[model samples]
Target: MSDIAIWLVRDDALPLGQRLTAALGATLYQPWQTPGDSPREQFRRCFHQHRQWVLVMASGIAVRYLDGLPASKYSDPAVVVLDEAARFAIPLLSGHEGGANALAYQVARLTGATPAVTTATEALKPLTLGIGCRRGKPLHDIERAVLSALGTRGLAEVREVATIDLKADEAGLLAFCERHALPLRVISREDVAARGWTGQPSDWVQQNVGVAGVCEPCALIASPRGQLIVPKTAFDGVTVAIVEDRPQTAVRHEP
Candidate 1:
């Protein structure tokens, strides 16, 4: 099921709701009645059911209804409130970890409204990953290797995935990126070679893929000014590297 739920009250709001659903890939929940359940009752049921909620009504209405469903920020789902005219998107609760702040910004972009984001942690962006694998390596192996590498450094999220162009159609890699909704950057072998490798030279990779190392090279090239934060680490047949892009100059990573 899609994690998003949108509630609309009036027919006039339907057009705006439809536009939001298309932009945000959300499911619409009209305040429909089922037997004795009224629209408000249905809204209450849906509020507890979904991971994220977008109520296209006055902010006051959302505040009044959500008063009873209160929980800790760690446990509550993201809640966003939008005006009927779509003029403003306010992250009513769980603005950071729950993703309401991001969702509000997304809704604002779709409807030309102002996104009022007040959460401090929302300012931090997700990390990007560059990876390489054996010809037929399974997805779980890649995932385990990457997760282990990230865990060592206390990093949690990935913004994008990068690999040599040769792996663009690699079934396991492609499926993994798609499943996680990560934008995949396919760097050409020539470009990766030009960037040069930061990791130890691998004669096997040099003979097979014409690169000194696939993971470190791809990661370095993907972030133009970034240096390797995590050097090429191998697990099973997969290799993972991490780079942190600085705003201006690159910083050296300790070996």
Candidate 2:
């Protein structure tokens, strides 16, 4: 009877569903467990009773089941969809108003999946942190480098963390992003090499990582419409840079 419900149609998804249930403190509902009621009926009951939902199945199935149930953004429960592979956590409904976007991030943190947030509010967030570190660098070093780069800026302003795809699986970087609840954006090495960067290139990086630089170019690529506020700064063995998006001013129309 938790406020959150996790529904899975397949037995294969049960493990992930259980993990999500434990992490999110949600009730897991399965087909066989529905007493006398059909899975769809159970889904309907959960939909109305819960404040949030995690649907672990194909998006089409979730959509088919949810077709006529959504009442309003304000009243409808937030819904997050995850594939059986658990590679992506998507906020399928009520992204901004119903807290699905935040829930998706939480799921990603728990599963090491990527949170696919499509909301304008999340996209327009001002700051992006670009980070690079040695292989197997511990979380504390990465955290220190990022904090130093942030300086006076707070973590709330940060939209995402950007890193070269080579470092996408870096444990330290992942831990830092998870700790801060920041989505990690992985930029391809080719894209980073093709882009222009401001700071002096690193010889070691050129030879070892096959890139001229990691932090600044990653920040630039991740925030295409942004300006680099902090150049590449190193702490221990980790490098960190920050980018800030140019503010958009809305036009006021005179009637």
Candidate 3:
């Protein structure tokens, strides 16, 4: 489970905070209940303690508590703010890399509120995971290896999975992708080779798969504008690769 800390400062927000804790399986911290630490101190402690934080209070209060701790989006913890009424969830900081937008969407789904997601990538859901494994590899092993590799970069959600066309009908790969609710993309060998992957070369892979490595090339081909965030990492005959879609630059027309 991702490390999450849910904070509540008002009695009216208690039920919603508890619901989030139960639905999302997060740690709920009520500073009043603890009765020792100041609100700012509690916020600082929670910020350092968790990867994602949900503040169940006014947005201004949330902003004030986080006053001096803002870091770059990639390194900062995701922060979501919901009013005491829980009518809406807003991803206040670190919307994409820190996963605040996705967390807000999840909170809205559970609480019957609206999620105000402003991040372009989170709205598009363009990330994909590329995988390769030996025949009959266990689904659990593939899942574990992929999670382990992606967790290092703080990316847990993938919109889809890509692999060579030869593995399209592979039962283990299909099952693994299906279990995660991600679409499976089967890439042709020619498409994989065109990407010019720089991953580790293997004689056995070249002989069998017609490519240097399956995971790296497939990920690159599937997400053309993406950068390989995590390169091919192998465990127990399963290899996992991650690619994140790069933010597109806006083109201005000459007036």
Candidate 4:
């Protein structure tokens, strides 16, 4: 049996729970499975038995259930809270020491949900790359485009790569991410259309992809509080934009 447990309170979320179970090789637990036990009892049992947990329910409910079960960051299970809508995957506990942040990113990649990781280590990362390219563009072209955009910066400062969902399975993009070991975050077309970005609109993108533009919008969406440091720069067949995360403001002392 896998060490990961996926828990859901509602019947409606069962489908998503099952999908996660299959993807993560996790065991699924629902209230209906054990009629004799209360929901809390079932959750408690799974909580102690599993090393990692994916909770498919409201954040409030997950918090209430997890109230006293946690021991410490060192020993507590990694807990990720996902909503029924599957819009966001948030790492609720054990963000670093227990791997909740990594689990959240994996869940995001699997379900196309945005990973809302709030850990300081991740939040402090400087840049996110937004890329768009023609289908079948080679890894070298994509790498060159990204490197050209980075100029003085190195890949180490990039937190992740952002792109439209259409390119989520693009071979070259996947290869580039794999080569650099960077997490790829994909934004849906619907999300791209809904979000406001300042990049020059592209007729090709609008007619073909049904979005205003790809690179800038995706970078802005991936790092919601970030600013585009490098606007859309085009190579032969690829476009790349770089967004820098807003730096934390230092508190000023009255002298």
Which candidate number has the best TM-score? Answer: 4
Superposed by TM-score, candidate 2 places the C-alpha of residue 202 at a distance from the truth, in angstroms, of: 10
Pairs of residues clashing in candidate 1: none
Q: Quick one: ranking by TM-score, best first?
A: 4, 2, 3, 1
| RMSD versus native structure for model 3 | 12.9
Candidate 2: global Cα-lDDT?
Answer: 0.85
At residue 206, what lDDT does model 4 achieve? 88
For candidate 4, give the lDDT.
Answer: 0.90
Q: What are the runs in model 3 whose C-alpha is more than 4 Å off?
A: 1-123, 152-156
Q: Which is the better candidate, 2 or 3, if ranked by TM-score?
A: 2
How much does candidate 3 score in TM-score?
0.50
lDDT for each residue of candidate 4 in 1-255, tens digit (9 for 90 to 100): 688989999999988999999999999987887778789877887787888999998999999989889988999999999999998899999988888987888899889888998888776778999999999999999999999999999998988899999998899999998899777898888888999494688888889999889999999989877889999999998999999998659888899
Q: Which ten residues in a row have the lowest lDDT in candidate 1?
A: 119-128
C-alpha RMSD values across all candidates: 10.6, 6.4, 12.9, 3.3
Q: For each predicted model, how many residue pairs clash, with residues at least 3 apart or on different chains?
A: 0, 0, 0, 0
Query: Which of 2 and 4 is ahead in lDDT?
Result: 4
The residue-by-residue lDDT of candidate 1 on 1-255, one tens digit each, is: 568988887667888888888877888876642557876777777776788989898988887778788678888889999999877889999987788876886676466565665665532333557898999888788878888878755333564567887887688887787666554666678878887776587888889999888888877766666667888899898989987766544688899
Better-scoring candidate (lDDT), 1 or 2? 2
Q: Residues 90-209, candidate 2, lDDT per residue (tens digit)? A: 999998899898888768766756678888878767998888888999988888778778889888889998888788779988888889877787777777888848497999999998
TM-scores, each model vs. reference: 0.49, 0.62, 0.50, 0.84
